[model samples]
Target: MYHVVVALDEDADRARRQSRAVADLPQAAREVRATLLHVFTDGEGASATEVGAVRRASDVLNNAGVDVEVIERSGEPAATVLDVADRVDADCICVGGRRRSPAGKAIFGSVSQSVILQADRPVLVTGGFEE
Candidate 1:
């Protein structure tokens, strides 16, 4: 049974792509457990809006026939994700990295890199609404 954690960024494209990946992940997966994680970026990253999104995602997943969980927390995005990974002992963390220029990445660093480096498990990263 693998535990998959997806970081739900507010971008519609990212969310769509993330949804595709999760929905299409091999149905053969034994004991598949999926979780939608959102961080509210106000120093703690826990916002009512984010929490609602996660809850909505969870409902969608449930309707799709997959057991799902929604988790919302307050903290740095990367830090919050890593912390959740620990609590859930996740097998993989999925996130989307906006395609940005070198300058942008330099200024913002990489969310994917942060999760990969900070997490104890593997990280799956993709651009928003990959088509």
Candidate 2:
């Protein structure tokens, strides 16, 4: 049994995609536990908007019967997710990815890539339904 940390974003659609992806993972049912991680995603202050997103995600996962937990911290997005992974001793991390054209990747860089480089554990990448 290993810990799996999922990178949850502020978007409701993205979070739902992530939840379904986690449910489909081959290891999801076999794993001892799953941690549905979402960072504050703000620099410092806790915005009421962020609070709502977190609650929305928490409720979604909980209703799905996920062995899930929410992690809220103010920091860099990728850094916060990686920090949570370390804290939970996650064996693997999963994150939602948007469609990135080659040029787009060159310009904006990839959030999933950042987490992969920053985290000690293996990272899984998934795209939303439209992506």
Off by over 4 Å in 2: 26-32, 41-44, 47-53, 129-131
Please name the candidate that would achieve the greatest TM-score relative to the true structure: 1
Error of 1 at 28 (Å): 6.3
- Deviation in Å, model 2, residue 85 alpha carbon: 0.8
State each candidate's clash count: 3, 0
* lDDT tens readout by residue for model 1, 77-105: 89888888888888888887666677877
Tens-digit lDDT string for candidate 2 (1-131): 66678777767777677677666666555553567766655365664235654566556656655677666566677887888888888888988878877887799787788997777778878775433
lDDT of 1 at 49: 44
Pairs in clash, predicted candidate 1:
40-45, 44-74, 44-75
